[model samples]
Target: MAGRRRSGGWRALLCLPLAGAFSLTALSGCGPVPAPDDPEGRDGRAVQRMLDQRAAAVRERDADAFLATVDRGSAGYLAEQRRVFRQMSAVPLRSWTYRLVRTGGFEPARVGGRSLAAQVELRYRLKGYDTAPVVSAQYLTLARRGGQWYVASDDGVVDGKRGTEQLWDQGTVDVVRGAHSLVLGVGQDRRVLRAVADTADRAVPVLGHVWPQEWAGRVVVEVPASLGRMAALLGASADGYRGIAAVTTGEVGGAGDETPADRVIVNPEAYQVLGDFGRRVVITHETAHVATRTATSASTPLWLSEGFADWVGYRTPGRTPRQIAPSSPTPSPPGTCPPRSRATPTSASAATPTASPAPMNRAGSPAA
Candidate 1:
């Protein structure tokens, strides 16, 4: 992965961008075509080789060399590029698919030596997920550098537009342990959700042994489609936080119009980015927040809250970050929150158990 370098002082994973084909554009100044001796299939083969190299770098979470190959310009562009890589690092291989949709702009005398542009479609299959596949049309630019062709840019990449209601209508949740209620829905694919529900159903005194006792009655477990729509509309915020899973509402302690807990929302599109145990791990991480008595607090630190969530989410079995991101001394503000004086916790409130929360769990609700 990202070597040992972490971003600023935070230990949270630094998400990077994945290179899409539709985003890159080849400008004017047409170079002469290759010699007639060039094999007809060579161009595609060359592109494949370049893709393999880039993929290897991605697998390693090497942002520096990855952007270097793409001719990224300006700090903002480079920053966004790195973000794509970080996101890609989390996606499972089986869920991601790249297909060549078109090919042209073949020319010579390009930076790095030769240049070619191709149109490709990237379809991220959502596995065990009820949401629509996040599809992107990519424009890929390639250049030969030091005798080796490299991916230069990806232009016009668009995440698939879909509604969240569609996702929830597709799956079912076996249990809904909330402060208000438990919800029962219908669907198939009853594996993990069922297992978790079964564990809860038996009341076998397992939660404390499996998870922290504090999580008892505090944890809210939802199925894949639980909040699909809310997630889609809020995945990417207007602020710099690209690909935001959800925003936390309110503060850690109830003070100055403060609430007891914060609200958490997620984007279904983000689920498609996960590979391996990504889906379960992310959900668990978010759920851990719900389990906490306090909203995220300064005393907890970014690394502990985020990293510990990740640690617990992956606690299921056989899941870990691909590469540890470089640590940063500076901490990123949580979502669009403004700075304020920290408030002290009055006391731990008793958690109430009830049926499904009507506001949080809207039956057959669509993404707004």
Candidate 2:
């Protein structure tokens, strides 16, 4: 089943109508505040200046300048930056309340020699529809260079904890077990979980190679409630593990009881497919993988895992499988999986392959 891809964090925001039009050329900096120009202090100022400038560019929807300031070398840094912008792009800024906070420590950044690393906290107010006025404490690293400051990173910290995922839409949600009711605020979370779980159950069969039925009795399944939530979960997961891992929603830590044979964690984002009613189809595709034990390792190729998932997902009722596009290279020989039977959608909404989609938790584990 094809699903509409959520915008990739910063990279996607860069392409937005508003963000892509403005041009920000004037750089931000403060004149000499003290004698000798404190490199550490200067770096801090530089980073802050960059942060403010980037914010303005984002507000102004200035594409060129935003990209120029950020260093794409660090994957985590890039992803984090993108995630914030993606939300900003979706939710227009109504107003902002900025207050000085604190910097716990200072160091130097390896990316650019001139930048200093200091953790600074910012208290601000964000207003959006459906969401209450959000009072947040954001954490950021400031770097000093030459005589200016640049933001090394913004961790999206709020009230000392990182911000939750910013979900954009929750439409036509369905739940399998509980009588899930959708409320606007806190109650909405519970529904998100229930609906996501139901989606995962529907997905189990579609991810065949990774989710063979042999382990069905033992494996535990998990799902993230919203798309925004998946970002934080992905961040936590990315702290460890590498390569293609899926980051779905829900809490961290392990099920602790299941063995490799019995546990399979599902990506709640897979539920995004549900938006088009193709969710059950897509989840089955992913679940099939979990059941099959298909994970990171050169042994299992991307095309193979993806193609297999698609194959399993196509089996759902009402689906008409079609052959893989001639444009794509088959992971296995053409005959390995059953011939595609589902009629492909007029416009495919599949998530494009970027760096691996999944992130493993700190324990060096996927969200099983």
Candidate 3:
């Protein structure tokens, strides 16, 4: 959970990368290796060729070519793979890539002792959805049939664990793209989806005016149907997320020039209860965190960060604390009141002025 540190002006929760037996390396292209006369060497080369074919099929979105890479002998596996392909076809993908991390030594298979297995990392991104590629480690078992190596099992569990499912696997999500924003949501509520899109439309220009132009001014907001789904997306426990309206999550450090895969996740239940004004406040506050994501660090105080966002959100609404607090009696005191104690100007308390506090909820907590 090192990635989950609250160091970047927002609370973060990082999912653990799928672990495997092979040493990790950045994906890169490699030249073809010369064929060896040894049987083991020949088998390894054949497996690598099969893997390259599979990767190419995914990139090209060729269903026939993809299916050809799988072993046809296993009818059950092939059928399930067909279903997965159908699901993937429904979603428009921006890019898909697979890298062969390592090829393990030839091992015995269920059919006979002529099969081999390898581990690989698959990374992909969906159009108008994912900002960065999602990575997963998969175990693949291959077998030689008709003088060709075909994938016998694509998802063999390593260390008794399987990789996390892709976003498309969770459920059907409708994507709406604006000039400067991409909004993704589940379910059939087109009205709610349009409302989110409209809010993002109004927010982008305001954010551009209020924040530095270091970022591209592009934002992606995800509104899951339930808080449970939101928790799953942020890699946090549902119980820990109670009463939270929204959160900004992504990778922290990089070149600090381009925006990373940061996204604003809205708590569905809490957000549904908010009226127009409240919705704007919450969205703008979260967007502020996204705009300043690269600048804010772990050392930034939460109060200052949250306070600035609150100020930006409430500044233009023309609502004052006194107007909100109608029940409180207005006290008319003398212009100059007697000092209670002789506090020095350099003192911490003396340096700070007591101003009217922001409106709070019935539970005495500040509203987002």
Candidate 4:
């Protein structure tokens, strides 16, 4: 879920940092712990109640009620939260909820009143957009004021690590709604966002043709200002993400329920260098991952998953490999590539139509 990083300490549990294209990993970092209290669970219940109200406020779009959950005495934190809520207005949320993970996950040295550091998890979905919820790890410094708990500061550290950067945290969120997409950008031009939406809108139908499953048919894209900002949002060093055009966040394998819509985070710098044909290929390729990966497990071989995506992406006849990667050397043959054991994507070629990609076993190979 992270693109990942240490926030002041409440970072999301993460796996599979991406490379030039994309990668998939399951999320199961934080485990549930018993209630903080021995029997009554009064203190834990109170904190959860306050958090419930906070989640309700966002769902209902009530600023005053939203602010009520925060410590009123903390002027600086209160003001900052005011701005965060206002920015959220542009984005649409279908569901929002908080689950208490564990108490005493961390200790905040300096606080105004009675404080308890807890690890929390936030699950939220964009209305008419997301199929499953996007999960985030939360750290809270809860304050007991007048016998009730108020969120003192969520920016606190958990286990000496901080959380990832959120889309809203960047700046004023500029939302562009395409027929089949929702583009959210910060410190980016409106024209750039619309183009992203248009590209995504076009990709959805193409995905439907090859991907035999139900999907939201739409995607939510996060467009940060620069490559560095993109890396920060992913919580990684710029070096790892430097030339990578984009990355997707979603479950690798799970078909019984509709998988969540992927957040196709774009690297503006790298993406811009890709011309019209190049841009279409990349966006379409990533969207195909969103569609086809519902049945792919973490143990699925890179060849099968990526090769499947490549198969779906470069569907146009006579397309060449150089057009996809640009920097790679051309294959010896003009329109076709050399054969291999499994259908993994090669630098100079895309997967063929008959390449037998199928259900994967934990050993990273096709099942019998």
Q: What TM-score goes with each of the models? A: 0.30, 0.32, 0.60, 0.77
- lDDT for 109 (candidate 4): 31
Candidate 3: tens digits of C-alpha lDDT, residues 160-181: 5543344444466677777777
User: Model 2: per-residue lDDT, tens digit, 1-368?
Assistant: 01212322333454443443344211212122321223244333544566666656665656666665566555677656555454345333444333324344333346555444444432222222112222333445444455555556654343345432333222222222322111121113555655645555445434433353443311133333433434443344432323222422222222222122222233443433234344444445445544444233335565775566565655545432222233233356765875574654221323322122322111122322
Q: What tens digits encode model 4's per-residue C-alpha lDDT throughout 94-199?
A: 8999887767757743468678876788888888888788777778787788988887777767545566567887788999999988999998999999999998
Better of 3 and 4 by TM-score: 4
TM-score of predicted model 4? 0.77
Please give the lDDT score at residue 232 for candidate 2. 43
Question: Which ten contiguous residues of candidate 3 have the minimum total lDDT?
Answer: 359-368
Top lDDT: which candidate number? 4
Where model 1 places Cα greater than 4 Å from the true spot, the runs are 1-40, 62-65, 72-76, 87-97, 104-115, 123-136, 143-148, 157-368
The clash count of every prediction, one per candidate, is 53, 50, 1, 13
Which candidate achieves the best TM-score against the true structure? Answer: 4
Error at 367, model 1, angstroms:
14
Query: Where's the lowest-lDDT run of ten residues in candidate 4?
Result: 359-368
**For residues 101-218, could you state the per-residue lDDT of candidate 1 as single tens digits?**
5455332223444566665554443223212233444566656556655556554232343211212323322343423212223332445344434432332222234445443242
Cα lDDT, model 3, residue 185: 76
Work out how many backbone clashes candidate 1 has.
53
For candidate 1, what is the lDDT? 0.39
Lowest lDDT 10-residue stretch of candidate 1: 349-358
TM-score of 2: 0.32
